[model samples]
Target: MEIFFCKSWFRAKKCPTEMWCEEQAKAAHEDGKPYTVLVGSIEQPYCFLEVTRRAVGVSFLDQLLRESLSYDFQEVEPGILFLTMATYREFEGDTGKVESGTSYIFGRDGAVTLRREFFNPQRLETSASSADVAANYSPKPEFGRYEDLIRVERSS
Candidate 1:
């Protein structure tokens, strides 16, 4: 799967040229598989502002999709790929903190099969400062099955 994270317009100076972005979009469209162009914004974290489609035309690339963060995941399992991204921030003076994480599982066809998001509740509630929290913090293990199947036998 070809996944591109496009930066918003205000950051145009840091983005690729309009023509280059269009060429990339055109190539992805021609491949005829699952390709995603996600528009990103500074105001939003852990989510995309928009998912651009080919039908929108190259002109749309001018407005968005200029800067891209591309990722090419190799199949970890048969026909499956996994990706994870996280953000951890500690406020100045250890007054507060923010921790957010997300994971994605993609199929060989370039479709997302599973997505998981995690956040620290302490960040929202009145709790100890970041330093105090860190002193007692212990990372917890998360477990789950990515796939499940069921079979039934008919009684004669």
Candidate 2:
């Protein structure tokens, strides 16, 4: 097990020895505009070809059904993809909130966008402490052992 922290302003000023990895890919578009597509992964793969695939070629989440097919992704026919760890987090308070951490997913097509706090582990201020700042305050309590699961598929 391992712990990780976010690399934000607060985190940068306090701690300089943190690991935050980002993943990106070059997608070919029929329009000739090179689209940069990236996603978070939990494991390292031998090649990108093992992960990239088309919608018709791969399986996708049911929630993505309504998402614009032109921008969403699909799994590879063989169900092969990429895996990697994009970010990590630390305990912030008694409520189980993430006090400090870097969310690798963001932007329209970031590898690890969309942070949903389904379970409030901490009762800390949601606005007072920014994610980047919390990450800087202290290292993730037990992030050294946590593992993120990464899967790559064809860009829509």
Best by TM-score: 1
State the TM-score for model 1.
0.22
Q: What is the TM-score of each candidate against the true structure?
A: 0.22, 0.19
- TM-score result, candidate 2: 0.19
- Model 2 clash count equals 31
RMSD of each: 16.6, 18.7
lDDT of 1 by residue, 5-124 (tens): 342323334342232254554454455322223333332221222212211111112222232221222324443332221122223232222243222333333344333333545323
Error of 2 at 138 (Å): 32
The digit string of per-residue lDDT tens for model 2 on 99-155 reads 544323322223344332323453322221213311111111111211222123222
lDDT of each: 0.26, 0.24
